[model samples]
Target: MTTDDPATDRTDREDFPDWLRQLERDIRPGPAVRLRIWCRRRSRRLMGAVGVLLVLALVAGAAAYGSGHLRRPGPAAHPAAGPAATASPTAAPGPFAGTPAAGWPAGAAGIVLPAAHRTGDFSTAQVSAGLAQVRAALLTARLDRAFMAGRSPDPLLRHFAPAARASVRKEYATETIATYATRLAPDARLAPDPPRVSGRITYQATRDNDGARKLAVTTNFVWVYGFRDPGARSGYSVVLLHDTVVWHLPYPDDVAAASRGLWLHRTSSYGWGLDCGTIHQGLVRPGGLDPAAAPFPEDPEALYDPDHPIAVPTHC
Candidate 1:
């Protein structure tokens, strides 16, 4: 069906080229790791093209692309006031009021663990201990004020084994710090309200190619930040980061004590509502506030749903 609206037709022609370019540049192809990522992107793009209105919707609402399915709260209806009636109480809206994150727990409280159970070689008690350490490291990396402000990530690095810590430190200098922790760009400022978070932690007993016993703790979490302007009452610009990290705990009997602590095994991440230019600088810059750098459009479920498959080629 062709639209009588010339404006809509013009928009489709203008936006498709840039959107396709941004998507291609952001996804790097690799033989072993990026094949799946490339396919997923292809499929999604095809579907969007087939549904013309969907592509238009995505382009029109680009600023909110990764901010989760934009769920603006409906206006509240008030009962007619009378001397015979009493006022009802209602909780005020929160920082995430219009996003999917509105109902998620605030900050670290959202990073919850399940009841520990035996797995492979690890007993219930061992699993609990390993998960606790992983949780602490996550809090330090993502929510620590200094770390997020681009300060040294030593606090997070220290949680890894000595050798792993050294490796991570090197990666940080090369601007790979965002893979290990969420850091704000030099120009960005978070709102007074703490970030909203939601996700899960799971663990399993596993072995490496060397056949050494280890406990693997995996965390998949999404953090949503609302940026504050100098004197604004509230921030409309939001940054959403989804990170998947696997922490490895070497068996005490399999290695020296120095190597027995938690080590970073693997990690991947993707973000929405960010200035992509700053992503290469290893910092998150909320984009909605900048007219020239509006956030890139992405599938809301792909970012907000923890059970969704982790995005690959995690460059931006």
Candidate 2:
């Protein structure tokens, strides 16, 4: 007792407060050990919460990426809905608009002319009216005076080649009905009773050449002049001339070889009328002549000297 042993005395000491003693007894090892265990439990709970938040963030990111990829235009894409979806304005009317009359003339099938013909056989009255209209249109600018006068005017001058229009205008200051007649080659006649006033005209036209191929075509036209009044004078005349113009279809080889020199001729009540005459000639290249030309005037009044040949290219 007189000599205290430090280790044993410390272990057996009871000098601390009752609360401290109780606390020490409550902890299994020491206060520091208890603090370390509490801290580890808290750290595990915090880590679990952080993991849950990270998982939620990843899921949200994936959904956002998928949504953007699906919503992303090109040829394969559907066309946008707009005014372009409507039908074109120039489409032809239905078949009900005009039907061929029953019991059409012999050699005439429906409103269309048949292929092949006898020597005496010629175009029907319907076809003739169409030709007349075409002639008048071609001669419009060239026969203003003749139109004003009461004479049957030449129709070619009005519908000359678009290129020749300027030249004709320059040469013939004022187109006269007499000038129109002058341009004709003498033998031409109007078909007595042209086809009916309404409906399309179709015909099988063959070329003048022996080996020429025939073709079928339908044409529609508007006539600016009507049947002239025998007694009345001074009125704007108008009529509807619709018919088919069937002409021989040139063979591919002939068309290729002949270039612009090919043309078709027809005999009319008035005179010999040449068609496809105004076509330009030259190589098939830039600045070349067009293969389809205007009809040449055979009337003496409208004729150009062959020897001197009008400056206009009349190769055909």
Backbone clashes in each candidate structure, one number apiece?
Answer: 0, 35
Candidate 1: tens digits of C-alpha lDDT, residues 107-165: 88898888899888888888888888898898888888777885686887878887677
lDDT of 1 at 152: 82
Model 2 stretches astray by more than 4 angstroms: 1-39, 73-316
Candidate 2 local lDDT, residue 235: 18
User: Which sections of candidate 1 miss by over 4 Å?
Assistant: 1-94, 230-234, 288-302, 312-316
C-alpha positional error of residue 229 in candidate 2 after TM-score superposition, expressed in Å: 22
At residue 204, give the lDDT of candidate 2.
51
TM-score of each: 0.64, 0.23
lDDT of each: 0.76, 0.33
- 1-316 per-residue lDDT for model 2 (tens digits): 2337897546533443456557777753454764565566578888899999999989898888777666642237776787756665885322112223111231111133233332222335433544444334423422233343323323333444333344434433232222122232122221222222222334454454555443333333211122222222321111221222222323334344432111222211111112222111100101112356565445332221112222332423
